[model samples]
Target: MKRDPPPPPPQPFFFFWGPPTPRGRGGGGGGGEKKKNFFCFFFFFFFFFFFFIWKRRGPPPFFFFGARTRTPPSPPPAPAS
Candidate 1:
């Protein structure tokens, strides 16, 4: 005999509340395959930095690690006699 149609998929426990957010609880795909906030932040920072370096010859001397070179101040003018 022909079998009846399979049962419908199970409804989400809290699906009635909202569609679903990326921040949903575990197993919610929150940590399954999606990227974390830290990664996104890092990605954006590097992306912006890449564009900034391209736009402006490289990061300012201050943003570098280790001691950086400082701009030399103008020499004092010679005293008038």
Candidate 2:
């Protein structure tokens, strides 16, 4: 009896699976970048805002840690006769 032709060899893994996916790279990381940039922008904006107010007005009465340490100014000296 005649023998049947052997089956063809299996195809390469990539041929079925398609190109390999990039690892740890692409749109997934965009959110973190945006968050980081937002935080940075917020920090700088508040820093400059407070700095401007400080220049215009002066140091605030209190600080995060505690109240201001400066003592009240003494009254002006009495006028000489």
Candidate 3:
């Protein structure tokens, strides 16, 4: 049978389906080089985060903080009869 070229990519946005989502990837993930690139991104994010904190040489991230909960910002409506 005859065939047509695939459609152009859509603009990125929040979607629960289609490629990389519920519908499953349209085109399967890439080759070795693409996988390498993805790992590279992970490495950069990790290193940059550590470097940013190291440069501070100041107080490390405050991992612990007391509870922040308080009264609701708005009053509830009157209860129905």
Candidate 4:
């Protein structure tokens, strides 16, 4: 009885034509990079936008003062002619 030639020594599977998959070390991280760059740009734009608005508008009213001052009372209405 011949032992089926030892099952041809069990060769490992391999694909020669398929594209090589990236592994480790800066591989498959494009999405994260895009997200990071987008967030950075968004943060920068937001900061500058607010800063520009602030500079254009100057300091906010009542920033230091606690409450608004009262206006002087108007004089009584003059007698009707």
Model 2, residue 45: displacement in angstroms? 0.8
**Clash count in backbone of candidate 4:** 0
RMSD of 4: 17.9
Error of 4 at 2 (Å): 36
Q: With candidate 2 superimposed using the best TM-score fit, by how many Å does residue 58's alpha carbon deviate from the native?
A: 0.5
TM-score of each: 0.29, 0.45, 0.34, 0.38
For candidate 4, the per-residue lDDT at 66 reads: 46
lDDT of 1 by residue, 13-74 (tens): 63323234454432333432243455577899999988888688855566576356766899
Tens-digit lDDT track for model 4 on 9-75? 2212322222222321122312334545666898999889878877999655665584545668999
List lDDT for all candidates, in order: 0.56, 0.55, 0.52, 0.50
Task: Please give the distance, in angstroms, between residue 19's alpha carbon in candidate 3 and its true position after superposition.
Answer: 26
Residue-by-residue lDDT tens digits, candidate 3, 1-81:
987555445424422223452223323331334545666898999888877887887435443352333446798889999
In candidate 3, residue 46 scores what lDDT?
Answer: 89
Model 1 per-residue lDDT at 37: 59
Q: 22, model 2: CA deviation in Å?
A: 10
Model 3 — which ten-residue stretch has the worst lDDT?
21-30
Report, for all candidates in order, the number of backbone clashes: 0, 0, 0, 0
